[model samples]
Structures are given as structure tokens and as C-alpha cells.
Target: MTSKKSITRRLTLLFVTASSVVLLALGFVIASSVGKHFEEQDMEVLTGKMALAGHTLEQLKSQNDLERITHLLDNSLVGHHGLEVLILRPNHEVIFATPNANFPIELVSVSAAQNSRRPITWTQGEQTFRGIAAELPTGISERSRVIVAVALDIAHHQAFMRSFLQTLWIFVAGAAALTGFLGWAAARRGLAPLRALREQAQVVTAQQLSHRLSVESAPVELAELAHSLNEMLARLEEAFHRLSDFSSDIAHELRTPVSNLMTQTQVALSRQRSADDYRSILESNSEEFEHMARMISDMLLLAKAENGLVVPTREAVDLAAEVLALFDYYDAVTEEKRLNLALEGNAEVSADRLMLRRALGNLLSNAVRHSAANTTVYVRISASLDAVSICMENTGDGIAQEYLERVFDRFFRVDPSRQRSSEGTGLGLAITKSIVLAHGGTISVESIDGTTTFTIILPRAP
Candidate 1:
């Protein structure tokens, strides 16, 4: 089994561990420093008392007064607990010592005198007691003067410091726990946005492409990411819509021809007939089928091109030559229809030859289909520094303003009832727009009065 990792838990653990380390170091320092100060104070008091006791013993008027001196000493030290005193000569012989039993009589500290005149100091039994030793200030009131010494117990001061440190450590540990808990809470609060982001991503799928993270409520750091995801979802939704519309368009466009073809095929095969009659019927039906197939193929091609599946093979081409060639091809038909095939100046542009041909061809077909018979359909190609435009204007029943924008939509028609019944795929304008867009160009239609013009603008040759 594995444990789940939590950010809050990690932050708390780290904070607590660091706090504990700092508190432990502080405790050690405080204990050492405070204990030293108290011990020094206790030693100073003991040293002073020792001197005073020696002076008192030496001030006695006669050697015969030893018993009186002892009694006075006992009375003086009665309330002074933990005090032990000893007096010694240069011969290391004891002259007097404190009667207090709570402290050892002479062995509390082994330190020698600080000088011939000052006391030495020591701490006893793991610093539980403070001790001082000194030469008894026994004066040579005579050469045989007696010495007095004292020891004071100091365990109480060290004990107080220890108790204080123990209580302080408990407080620090409690504060550490509280701070650790708070750190966990703060981490959780700060990371809430990330948690929400994760949950939202988990619930999202292609089915919910419309769903997007809310940038307004998200943290500033996540704002750009939320916006980018929303944009991607929007593009996907549009692509899906285009695919759906394209599928429906294909189904509607193929219905009538497929039904008619099936009927014609079955009927033509059902009965015996003369070979000429069979040939004529087969030929005509074959041409109709070919026309339907061509329309379907063109529609499919336009769909693929719009979707960017078919990339144009771009190249430099002589625009005027391509127009002239097309002019010759359509000139006979235009003449028979009494339309004018006009030529403009030569222009150069960078584009895909095949795609441009299709664009121009679609424009010519539109002109032929809509223009009045025996009237002039004018063609013009113009150029500037950065761009070139090919325009075709046909004299005809000009399109209504409302239908101008709708012309580029697949399967749409000016007449509502003929939308699905027209020979044209209704996608020629749509395909022209797609190809123009793919080539990094623009196309537009303008119609007023009896004039309808289609314009194609392409980038100029570099």
C-alpha cells in the first residue's frame, strides 16, 4: 500500500520540524546562560559570608573565649541554611567549620584559593551546588590567629532555572503544534484554485467541449491558461458544426439523382429494345449521372479544402497569360451568347495554379448562369504594389442585397424552393471563398441595379 501525499501535510511537517529545531537550540542557550549567572551569584554570597565569619572569629578578645565564639557563630548562621564553614592554617589544619549538616563540612569544592588573598570557586555534583574556598581572613591579631570558612548550598537556584526551562519548552511545543496546524490550513487555502482546476479537467471530455474554465473567478496566474482552453473549445465547436452541416448538405444533394438513376437504370434494363434506342437512353442517363457525380465530387473537394485537408501547392504564375488562355477557351461560347470577353493588363501573383483556376472557373460559370443572353460580361484584372484583383461583371438580374451574404453558404439558393433542386452545387461561391482564404486572399460580391460583379484579390508576387 502507498500513502497519499498531501501538500498541507508536507507544509505542516516542515514548519514544525524547523520550529522544533530553533526552540531546542534556544532552550540550551537559555539554560546554560541563566544557570551560570545564578551560580556566580551564589558563589559571591558564599565568599562574602566566609570573610565575615573569619573576621568575627578573629575579633574575639582571648583564646579562653572559644566556647562563647562558637555559640555566637551558631546563632549567626541559624537562618542561613546550606552554609558550611571551615577555617584552616598554613599547616592545612582546621581551626573552625560551619555546623550546617545540609552541606558537606569541607569537601564541597576542591578548588584552591584564587590567590593568597582570594577564594577559589567550584560547582558540585553536576552543578547542583555552588562552592567557594578562600584563605580565612584570620588576622595576625597574633601569629596563631584562627581561620573561619563557610560553604553555602546553591541547589535551589539551579532548580528554579530548570523548572523555568521545562515550562518554557512545554509552551514552545504547544505553540509549534498550533503554528503547524495553521500552516496546513494556509497551504490548503492558497492551493484551492489548483485543486478546482484539476477537478474541472477531470470532468471535461470532447462531449463537454462547450465547457471552459472561468477566467474571471480563477487566479491571475491561471488566467491565460483558462482563456487559451476556452479558445480551443470554441474552435472545436465550430469545426463540429461545419462537419454536421456538410454531412446534411451531401445527403440532401444526392437524394433526387440517386432515385432517378435507379429508376432509369432498372427501366432501361427491364425490357428488350433496339440497340439505337438503348444507346441513346444509356448515353443521356450516363451524362446526367456524370453531372451529378461531378457536382458531388466538387462539393466534397470544397469541404476538404475548407477543412485544410487539401493544401494548395503554391507557385508564381503569370496571371494575364492564365486569363488570356481562359479567355480563348470561353471566347467562342461568349461570342455565341453575344457576350464580350475583355482582357486587362498582365499581373503576377504567388498562388496555387490549380486552385486559382477553380476559383476563376467558378466565377466564369456564375457569370454565364446569371448574365442575360446576348449581353456583355466584362472581365478585368488589376494590380498594385502588394496585391492583384480579378473581377468579372455580368449584366443580369442583379441579386438582392439580402442574398449577397448568403451566396457563399453551401447549398443556399436565391429562391427558397430551388435551394436543393438547382444544377449548381451552391458551394461554388463557398469553395471560391475557401480557396481565396487558403491562399491568404479575399473575395467579395457587389450587386446593384442590373450589375453583379465577383472579385478575387490575391497577394502580389514577392
Candidate 2:
């Protein structure tokens, strides 16, 4: 299993990593731009010095005087501090060289025909220099030529750049640290709503399910989550109440029969009785046992159905046949009440034959029991291309509107009184609904105008 991690840490890491990448890229671009600007400035300075040397050489051609050129070079070197000048003849002879100047021969060897001007960098001892070399015409003879070399000290520039880069990196590191700290703080602050939600959720218990998340107060990003959590709480509360009621109803239903069996047995045992009296008492106890058994059996069946253990056999079942069979079974009860049993419409559905019969029997039994005397208990089945609907409608003092929705709930009764009568174990409709649901169908009940209809709709067999 994957381990859980804190959302705050994840967000902090993301923010810090992104900021670091951006800062690093920006730092690189700025460093490169500054370096290029300094290099260009150095090249311009070197080019100007080369131009000055060429002008001084041009003035010497009119005199054809080497001494005059030497004097001018010395003066130029003295006037411009940190400047080096070297003058070479066409025969590779060094005509003039400034004090402490050691210009590279390679620079002097460069022919004007090959390249008019060339800039180069050279290091002497501990200092670095940038210089340019140009071959100039003497105007005295066709073979007479002068190579002028000029260089500027760039050691200070190098030192400044090194210091600038060190400082830039230091500032970049500081900025990254500051940004990461700020990002972590912002991430934590931004997720305060989620923290509140967690605290609220942690406090929730079964008894506190009625409490709901405050959607309106939540951030927009978390509103949907809050609403979903609230909805889940509502469902949990509803299920909890249903389970509580089911427990109470089960205990109430079982207690009566058990208490009666215990009382009757104790009374019968209290005094010696005739065999017939004892047999009668035993029969009464048997009846109570039978009721308890039926209730337990119904509860078991409902549990199986809910747990998806009721796998029904697929078979074509005739609805009318099932209705007629139930009518015959409940014939005595119906006749005593002077009720009429009517079967209308016809449809065949794919379902377990025994389950179908049981479902219809329950519906008919309920109809006959609740229905008024001389009223008709109508069983109707309608078929469509995809589904078949079975409606068991009865004319009687109909169920109240409030109880209609929960009529099929196990051990539920329209009369809240827990009196043990010939009515039922209060699981008849619940069993009917469970059976119908197992067959990929739905069962619903509605009452209106002294008429209640329980409708079962099942998918038609292909």
C-alpha cells in the first residue's frame, strides 16, 4: 500500500522547486548579459588604441625616420597608462617596443591582406590583457610596412566580473531561500480551510452524524468536497436511524411470543392438569413457536436478499396463474370477509417461480387482510416490450400518506401498536419487495381515495 503524505509538504515542495528553477534561469541570463557587455566594452577600448597607433605610424612615413617613430611610441606609452605598443618592420624586426612590453610574435605576424584588424587576449605573469594588431602602410616604399600592436590591462575587469558573479550567486541563493520560506507559509495559510474540514471531520461520530459541513464558508475549491461530505453524513444518519428502529422492532416482535410461551408454560406447570388441558396448552405454545419461527425465517430471508445471496433461478413465470393460485390459497379468509378477488390483464416475466408465487401470495394476503368487506382485491398485470408490471390494488381504509414511503420496511405496520394478532409478522410486504428486487425489479406502494396500490415492475424475459 502507498503511504499517505501531507498535502502541505507536497505543495511546499512544488512551490519551492518551481521558484528555484525560475530564479536559476533568470540568474544565468543576467550573468551572460553582463559578461557580454563587459567583453564588448573591452573590445571597443582596444580598437581605439589600435586606431591611435595606426595614426602615429602614418605620421612617421613622411620623415622615413625610425627615431621619430621611437620617440612618438615612447610618448604614447607614457601618456596612456597601462597601454603597450610594439612596432615591427616588414623584415620581422622590432623597430620600437615600450618598456616592459612583450607583445606576442603571432600578433605581429598577422598580414593586413589576411585580416585588417584582429583582437586577442594574452596573459603576462599575473595580469591578463586584451589587444589588437594591424599592419599599416609606410607610404615610403611598396615593401615598407609597419605592424602596430596595442593592448589594455584587463586584470581589474576580470577581478570585477569574478566578484560580480560571486555576488550574483549569493543574492540568487538568498532569494531562493526567502522564496521557499514564503512559499511554505503561503501554502499552509492557503490550506487552512482543509485543516478546518479535517478537524470538523475528526469530531464526527455516529451520534453526531446530524452535523454537516459548512459549504458556504468553505473555499470554492473545497465546496464540492464539503457538500459531498455533508450528503454522506445525511445518508449515514438515515441508515443509523433505520438500523435503530429495526433493532427495536425486532426485539418488540420477538418479546411478545417469547413472553407468552414462558407465561403459559409456567402457569400450566403450576398445577396438575388433565391431559386434554395440557395438550391444549402445548398447542397454544406451538402456535407461538410457529409465529416466532416465521418472523425469524422472514428476517433471515431479508438478510439474504440484502446481502446478495438470493440467487433466483431464471424461469418464465405466468403472473395470472400465480394470482389465481394465491386467490385459492387465501379463499377461506376472503370468503369470511365477503371480499371479491379479481385478476385482470396478463403478462409473463423471467423470475424464480417459487419466489414469484410467494411475492404474489404476500400481496394478496395483505390485500385480503386490510381490505374492507365486500370490496374487491384487484390483481392486474400489464406487459410492455421491455417490462411487465403487476399491481395489487385494494379498496379499503388506505394507508396514511406519511407511511406510504416506508410501507415495505421490515416489521413496519400502519398501526404502530405492537399487538400480536392474526395480521402478520409485519414482514409480508418487506419479503415481497426483497423478492421483486432480487429479480432486477422495483416495488412501490401508494394510497389515495381509500384505495392502496402496491406495484411490482420486473424486466420482461427476452
State the lDDT of candidate 1 residue by residue for 1-462, as single tens digits: 999988778888998888888888888888888877876676677777766776676676655555456676777777776777665655556555665433343443234443343433446555334555554433334555443445556667757877898898998899789878887888789788878877876766757767777789889988888788778778988888788888888888788678877888788889988899789888867876886877778887887887788777878888878877777878777777777766666787888898888788888877876778878777788898899988889998688999999888987777666543344667788888988888888899999888999888888853
TM-score of each: 0.64, 0.83
TM-score of structure candidate 1: 0.64
Model 2, poorest ten-residue lDDT window? 107-116
- The whole-model C-alpha lDDT of candidate 2 against the native structure comes to 0.83
Name the lDDT value of residue 256 in candidate 1.
68
Could you tell me the C-alpha RMSD of candidate 1 in Å?
Answer: 7.5
The residue-by-residue lDDT of candidate 2 on 1-462, one tens digit each, is 998998888887887788888988998998889877877887787777677777776666454475578777676556677777777876768888777676777755763335556567888788787777777766565666787777777788788888988998888888878887888899899999999999989888987888888899999999999999999999888878867877787898898899999999999999999999999999999989888999999988987897689999988888888888888888998899999999999988888999889988898888887899999999888999999999999999799999988888887788876465667798999889889989999999899998999899999962
- Top lDDT hit: 2
Q: CA shift at 8, candidate 2, in angstroms?
A: 3.1
The RMSD of every model to the true structure, in order and in angstroms, is: 7.5, 3.8
